[model samples]
Target: MWRLRDKYAIAGVGYTAFSARSSVTVRDLALEACGGAMADAGLMPADIDGVVSFHFNDSVPAMAVATGLGLPGARYAIDYQAGGNAANLIVQTAAMAIEAGLATNILCYRAMNGRSGFRLGGGRELAAHGVTQYTAPYGWISYPQAMAMWCRRHMIEYGTTSEQLGAVAVTCRRNAALNDRAMQRQPITLDDHQASRMIVEPFHLLDICLETDGACAVLVTSAERARDLARTPVYIMGAAYGGGPNQGDDLFDAMRWPDHSHNYARYIADDLWASAGIGPDDVDVAEIYDCFTYSVIMQLEGLGFCAPGEGGAFVQAGRIDRDGALPVNTHGGLLSEAYIHGLNHVVEAVEQLRGQAGARQVDGAEIALTTAGAMTCGGAMVLRN
Candidate 1:
């Protein structure tokens, strides 16, 4: 196991109100979230020495946010290349930086105008690249089409049904209703999910995540330093990030794996557990990435919440409800809540651990598991109170 486990902790978290449209630029959005986080941690701008962010270079960079916050120039600033699946890397990288004595009081954040500015799913000129050469030519132009293909395969092989998937959407909306910061707070029922417009054959409009305009930030420092912070410390128990075998290779060729139905989470689950010295049984709450309902189901299976092909049944049993065996996405998640990439999931986990979540708080959340996406690349982190 790594000595770094539990060495660094999240002292505070903050976010801007989620919305589909925001007049401010992404830079301002980042400042709002960072300022809130700084205040929550009781830290001054001069205290921060490091920063990290992900997704495309289009979003505000780490240095830009640092400057906006009036910080003494950062000693370590990184702009990671991966997208949503690499969200947890921001926290993990900051932990390593602090452990290495390279910096202290790192601010990790993500901000974007996903709806009004750069449409995440907007058409881009294909570069005729490696993977694009294989799939894009066959009319698999968007994530919906690509993920739909995977969901269809799961349905055929595992007997997963659209009704089972509807349960995920229903659960998220129910959670969103209790969160004032969420963009989509209106309650939704499974019947409403079925009645919603179809984005793809098996996926409905409600099944997809909202294109949100928002920013989320978290403050990380040594666990000892966190003891002096304004908020209770949430320790980083475990974390891992990497690609899975056969992911995004060739749809047909990738199917030859022994467990082809599995996602990248399967590759990192053991590392996350071993590093934390805990298993699924120790988890009090989960914040699974829910870019789509089907993806959440797949992650549940991969994370060992249930056996393979049993995810649909697991969710159908209400095992992931707020009061169920393992409450998941208690802050609405990306499905109904605004998508600030996956940083909001981390914030929610911190709140759950600190007992700060008001109505949506799980009764006694002590160990919270927050995850990024599946597919080609992914990450997960275990946070403990």
Candidate 2:
């Protein structure tokens, strides 16, 4: 099979200030981010030939961004109907398109007013459809409730404690304290995590991710071209997207699923590493998705950082802290950082590999791994400088 490793690179990354409310429209937010990415790459808007973005029916289309950025008849433009799970997959798609000779410079982005409008926690009534029809009437209306079931299952099956989950939240906030752009920079203790009001039974208010109005974007191009760009070229070492058994079915239908204790990470880990020609230990830093605290522990187990049933203990031991064996979410992550879906995670990985992450920078960082989503279908990627 053909390999994508080292063939493409993330030439540039950019983000707008994250906030609870924005004075501008989501389209304006996307334009600012895309323009910033282009400028960072030392490219003009006319040089871009492709545009890609993902949203949960909350943002504008790729063409709208392309036109707003003044791209001259974009060659390839698409908007995936997805959420955080597609974060890595969209970059992979852009790179594949570049390799296929479809587009040269593609801008992949995610922009949303997750806090000011269209909250993921069910700010508005959703039409009854798919498994939601069966689950919604029973009060399973938001993502937190659906994810809480999986968290509870992990606790029951592996004796995971709320304190262990608290470790993840506390660590994220600690990292966010060093990130000027993070929404929640105040450090919190495990006791604070425990004392915070519960949003769902297994998730405290601090355990959940922050919803912010913001946009993040990256520029994708061939490695050869990226070498001549403005910043250090972070090559795409590998990428994988898909899920395990019954993944094609409605993911929220936990009743029909086989294992609630695990997630998509395990199924994709082998392929992700094999394609990258590295293992978990080879990774210098990681940006695992943390939509919720337990999601981080679950991905840690599934991504081969630790054996099954060891994730709770792994986190409790501080293996994911800034000074741990493998520093993770150095940009504060979704829990404390602004949630641009998971696209900001990818941006953070690029910065780490480029040696651009200032104080939180992992010493001599070379290879970086980033994962998006946990319980449902997800994707992951490896990057290297």
Across 1-385, the per-residue lDDT of candidate 2 in tens digits comes to 2289999999989899999999799999999999999999999988999999998889999999999998987999998998788999899999989999999999999999888987878733567776667777777878888899999999999999999999999999999998889999999999999999988898899889999999999999999999999999999998898777776445456575679999889888888989999899999999999999999999989989999899999999988888999888999999998899899999999888888888878889999999998776889999999
Q: Give the distance in Å from residue 345's predicted Cα in candidate 2 to where it truly belongs.
A: 0.6
C-alpha RMSD values across all candidates: 2.0, 1.2
Clashing pairs for model 1 are none
Cand. 2 TM to true fold: 0.98
Top model number, lDDT: 2
The segments of candidate 2 whose C-alpha lies over 4 angstroms from its true place after superposition are 123-127, 248-251
lDDT value, residue 110 of candidate 1: 91
> lDDT of each structure?
0.86, 0.90
* Candidate 1 structure quality by residue, lDDT tens digits, 1-385: 4457888999989899888888899999998998888889999999998888986765888889878888887999888876678678899999999999899999899999999999877754766576666666676676666567677878988999999999999999999899989888999889999999998887888878889899999999999999988999999999987656556553223343445366777778888888999999899999998888888888898878898899999999999899899898999999888898899999999999999999999988999999997565689999999
Using all chains and alpha carbons, the TM-scores for the candidates as numbered come to 0.96, 0.98
| Model 1 spans > 4 angstroms off | 248-260
